[model samples]
Target: MTLDVSEADHQRVSEAIAVAETGTAGEIIAITAQTSDSYHDVGLHYAVAVLFFYLGTVAAWPPLLDWTWALLMGWSAPPSERAMLTLLLGVALAKFLFVLFVMKWMPLRLALTPGATKTRRVRRRAIMLFKAAAERRTEGRTGVLIYLSMGEHRAEIVGDAAITAVTTPETWGEAMAALIADVKDGRPADGIVAAIALIGEVLAHHFPRDAADRNEIPDKLIEL
Candidate 1:
């Protein structure tokens, strides 16, 4: 879900938020992030895995060790134990470095990352952002964050303590489903707008607008 988010899309989301907030005191904040995490640690883990797998292969196959030794030192006498150890270390290091370098590309790194890891990372980031930008920000403590992570093709809805007290995470299933559907079809902006409308409905029901209600969070889509 690479963000091709346009100004018109942003305007539509802003307008959707405004309309949603008109009927509720809940402050809705929408944010779209290119990625939730860099996953450099995951890359390092991958490199280490590759290194170990290579070592294991060499250890499991005596012929492979001989081949590697020959490749490193051609037509020479059988290497000493110290030389073999150095050769294994050197080759393993090269494999590790090569994998690490390849993982520098974002798409490849993300593709190789496990789905559960991506989901967890996306959710974690959504919560962190919600805490920073929306949680307990409104007068009624009814702030909701609609977070979209394009890199992971995932979305999350986080409500402030006031809203969460009356509703469970499952309450946002419809909105999340709509968002995932639209995102899968490459309509990220439309997905966000639709999700906002649905979330607005929930907020209006759970926490209706008050006479003195004021907007605490900006009603615009943030792109990162």
Candidate 2:
């Protein structure tokens, strides 16, 4: 549960995660990630929204800034404080819409399984527990997402079920250890992901995605 991640391996680990979105957790589901600059995303959307909102303010400057401030903060403010609220209102609206639309809607549309949800929750718990335990023993995020982002010499167990799919846990652990070594030793993320996807494929061969299809896990995951 506890591990270390370093600074140099962040992108590699992130890329691996982005590509590892192929399987189901509880029953069968997919998860994915992508690199993003949220600051700019907020700024861009807010810039446009604010431009329009500001135009509305100009056309109908009926002292509605107080109401706008109330909407942003969930409380009212007097008109005397309407000077710099334009940017704030625009940014808040844009951010709320983004979270509601992209973060919320898109994931629901992905048709994730209850099993996948459980796995994700368990993954969070494991990581958090690792960090808490590490806090009892180590100095940093040895088992936290920070370590994953850092891409330290650490191997992650996706879950017990994931490991169970493999015939040999011993070999699986060894491969994971080797992967940790690879990342720590400066191997690229794509290569690391390729190695994992290959392992997933092998496991699928034995365990299979449906376990009934007798089909191989698609190789597409490796490309990610």
Candidate 3:
């Protein structure tokens, strides 16, 4: 799955960034991703849960195995202990595999992931991307990153050392709120633009532009 940010949307975000940086030496970078992690472990956990549930149900009801055995083998004679155990294992494996197959669909897999897990993964990914793309890259160490994960409907804002030294995470609360509100309304570009403007206001207050200030980062929205 991919974010539906069109070329026009990209241009809008780029312009927002350019305008935002005009008053501050700080560099602002924006990134959007379809998802942060595959959460394959979540899928494995689900498959195991289903497998155990099936086993528990069959254990509590032995006749279920008898009926299944009869339906499969069509035999009047009761199956041996070995046959019953084999049938149980086989059906449990089938159930597990069926669940695994269904979870291969990305939407279902993402939907099944816990909200806390999604939040953590998106934050972690945003941090990693910030470190690689924006952290300490500017002369004043005033770079900032705004990351959004479409699949999880989550966002994170990370600031470089200089910015963080003078401002707390709460400093970006209004910008974050603006971003989430517009994103939830299916206006990602608008959300980003609003966020950039708000962030610019904060940065300008703390790190006003100097006569020699330069654009340390490209003004664009990176799609990942």
- TM-score to true structure, per model: 0.95, 0.28, 0.95
- What TM-score does structure 2 among the candidates reach? 0.28
Clashing pairs in 2: 5-152, 6-152, 24-29, 26-115, 26-116
State the C-alpha lDDT per candidate.
Answer: 0.91, 0.39, 0.93
Error of 1 at 96 (Å): 0.9
Q: Residue-wise lDDT of candidate 2 within 45-115, one digit each (tens)?
A: 54456557655764587445555566756654453445445644665566556644553432332322233
lDDT of 1 at 45: 94
lDDT tens string, model 3, 153-180? Answer: 8999999999999999899999999998
Relative to the true structure, candidate 2 has a C-alpha RMSD (angstroms) of: 16.4
lDDT of 1 by residue, 108-197 (tens): 999989999999999999999998898767877899999999889999999888998999989999999999899889899889989989
Candidate 3 Cα misplacement greater than 4 A, ranges:
none
Using lDDT as the yardstick, the better of models 1 and 3 is 3
| Order of candidate numbers by lDDT, starting with the best | 3, 1, 2
lDDT for model 1, on a 0 to 1 scale? Answer: 0.91
Flag the better candidate by TM-score, 1 or 2.
1
Best by lDDT: 3
Better structure of 2 and 3 per lDDT: 3
Once fitted onto the true fold, the runs of candidate 2 whose alpha carbons sit more than 4 angstroms away are: 1-152, 162-168, 210-224
Ranking by TM-score: 3, 1, 2
